[model samples]
Target chain A: MAVTRPGGPVDGSSPDAVSIAVPERASTGPVVARALRLLEAFSDERPTLTLSEISRRSGVPLSTAHRLVAALETWGAVERDPAGRYQVGLRLWEVGALAPRGPGLRERALPYLEDLCAVTRENVQLAVREDDEIVYVERLAGTQAVGVHIRVGGRWAMTATGVGLVLLAHAPPDVVERVLEGPFTRHTPWTLTDPARIRETLAAVRTRGYAVSERQITSDATSVAAPVRDATGEVVAALSVVAHHGNPPVSVLAPLVRTSAGGVSHALAAGRRPRRPR
Target chain B: MAVTRPGGPVDGSSPDAVSIAVPERASTGPVVARALRLLEAFSDERPTLTLSEISRRSGVPLSTAHRLVAALETWGAVERDPAGRYQVGLRLWEVGALAPRGPGLRERALPYLEDLCAVTRENVQLAVREDDEIVYVERLAGTQAVGVHIRVGGRWAMTATGVGLVLLAHAPPDVVERVLEGPFTRHTPWTLTDPARIRETLAAVRTRGYAVSERQITSDATSVAAPVRDATGEVVAALSVVAHHGNPPVSVLAPLVRTSAGGVSHALAAGRRPRRPR
Candidate 1:
């Protein structure tokens, strides 16, 4: 049975990655690729796996899987669960947290995101465009937030979220075109699926410097988002606040989000966290 | 000039990792170990590197480094910046976020951590024991927090901070013995160095259900920490709130921190996030 899948892999299928041929000889390139593919075999659902399960999922032979896993364990890349199943290790998380696009961005934007969440008491999200999809970098749900829950590293289509739309509007020509080519998954009736409407929405986001997405995921929730730029004036990421619709209205939230996004952009450009008075 | 080193590696010296004889042939295990060593070469101080830098740091030859880097880049283990220097990639970050000890613990403990930071307006830190050290899982700084800045995955000695003391108190016997056999580094005059005092402090923490570290890290800061246990009642993590020493006194902060830690423990026991009200 298919198990250990969480929304699926963001970098594409692991099986295809593991299919790189290994010569009858010892080649470090193909072997390293296979080992990395084994890492891709893990997901939110399948956080832990037995040796056979790992071998099956990664397509690495059982003997090689054993040896590769041993080496990874030695380096703290994978840890054994209580049931003796392999799980991702803390050290790997430490190394990955160095990624400039993920935790590095989150570190700079968190203070502003916290401010947005506090002001609106709503769900605050920060995301960056990756290919035709958007990957959430940070998500803070307030104590009284609406029914909006987003996972860090969760991927969604550019048309499905306010931050996604803002990122989509500033995305490269090919990325914009690819996103506009529809087969969009609809979450609610209010989710934008029509290519023409989405195209118009993108244009408006560019003109207004913000995007408003209402009832896209839930009927009670509405989102207002703004773009975050780098020193190069790039739409590196997008920030959004999701709250109950018509409670405060989108106009009131847009300026707050835009200002916070701008603050984050400034911090990113300055390359230092803004110190607060103690 | 030994550049691009963070507080140094957590697992051990990584040059030893690369010295894993890459047989005159192609051995996948040793090669994968070498590539992982390249990852260890990156730190907070050096998040990006040129190809020559990577080769020099990882102890891998230039030609082999190029091929290995290519394979790694294909799998999104590393990425190239606009300047063509290599950095940790977002896809690797996404995969690493799946580590239960890191993001999973952080996700479960965050709401309570937010509540603590909000209530005390201080810095709240969560940590878990790894080997002979304590690895921080999360740190939230309140707007009015005191001067405490702990990186999410930063490691420290088991006797340095409140959370560290709490974790150290409950660690396995062999681990405790190793920590007690001192060559202890002292940070401040008040920082505990006497093994007898440290042992007594550990005993007191067990009896009190919490720990107090006053001016251990900074002259103005004091941290009160409590243990977070799983359903099995095993101490899996430590939660601490750091603030200006004796402002509200440890008497006031102790119960609050202990309660928050209990809530986190209950949440971990249930294995589901406590639902928040709207």
Candidate 2:
């Protein structure tokens, strides 16, 4: 949850070396940047698309999308399906596994995450904060667990889900204020919409060391979550468990979430965490 | 996997488009290709690197590495770590999740994968064949279980792991022949390097509907695996459970792997399989 990349140099120069050539103000200078955005347009909801579809989604012209997508395919960033639609490529996945905030975080929390699912027989999830939303990195589903739409690398509002709340509670004040400013997606009647109520819930999470969310993302689910910290004591992620509503009090799940979170923290500090070998 | 891309149009372009782009090969084509190669230099083991390290590893000149890293960072394929080293970026991971053989496979197998972990309390893994190697798509750890270094999106030799054996068994004959003919990586004393012995193991896996690898990768661990099929009844993935070598009888874990693999096959056929939502 703590990962944030500062803007770096745009030209191929030293970190301290500024660009001298005329800066292209129109955002069309680097071919690679355009290529990445085209790839980004394909998300969990829209993993496959036709040529024109990608062009429209990425706001690149058909000619440019053609060129960029070709470059991407050469590097194995984009692949085509049997239906001749394009999706992300395996090569990109191989490289993405190197990202510390994504698979790196998942590797560390996995054992404890599994234990939480086994002990509670509920859906266990791990997420990191990206901007104002939380991106799920890993999840373990119980056979009888309630349905959830969240997927690994999928995004959800920071005010609705249990992991989102825990991460947001520990987020900076500016981020909290930004989320309180509106455009919340309402999934169930129980989902908090009032900024004041969410503020109170954040304070409660800080006081109790966990967050309880009832039917916030789905009508039949309840979630409990706790913050996971790194070696420097910074909250880096959140571990959560979602179960069927009315099955047990959210308080029953608090201990499992907290213990798993602490276990993940210890694993991270011990450097025995799961990681894709280089 | 018979998933090779044609050499002409690296993008999702028609053959006609390839004919039109023949002239540009004389110009700055190396820049884009070199940049892609630079990004490829980062891996699970070498997640962070300095400028000279990247140049040395990618075999690109210092100026080229400088230019390419700048292009990558501008496009968010890479980012600078706090200590001024370069690391893979989150944007890359987001796009990588679109790989049909990577997270795409994991999404469909996650529920069944979780069940396998819960019932066995052993390390559960889901993997697909990538070239001659097995690329792990998902791995669910067990609490107090045997320790392992495998993580999601990691790769291992086809002759050295239970999942690898299942995949090699179901692969086309040519794929099998190619693997057996090449030099193999032997991780431990139990790793099968002799072509004849590996052929016998593959045959056994096919006949029994499961695979048992004893201390193949690690001396203290044993793994049992089964094949997962798609609607076409093609062996698209393999599921495995790694445990302490002497803890569970191979006979006991065999049925567990088959049963779980069966559930996953049924789910895939139904098209309602639980997966990462993307």
- TM-score for each prediction? 0.84, 0.74
DockQ of every candidate: 0.31, 0.26
Q: Candidate 2 DockQ score?
A: 0.26
Task: Give interface RMSD, per candidate.
Answer: 12.5, 10.5
Model 1: per-residue lDDT, tens digit, B114-201?
8998898888999998899988899887677788757788888888799989998999889989998977877778898888999999
Candidate RMSDs in order: 9.5, 8.8
User: Which docking class does model 2 fall in?
Assistant: acceptable
Candidate 2 lDDT over residue span B185-264, tens digit each: 77888878999999999999999899998998889999999999988788988999999997888888889888888888
**Model 1: CA > 4 A from native:** A1-26, A273-278, B1-26, B142-144, B273-278
Candidate 1: residue A149 Cα off by (Å) = 3.8
Which numbered prediction scores highest in TM-score against the true structure? 1
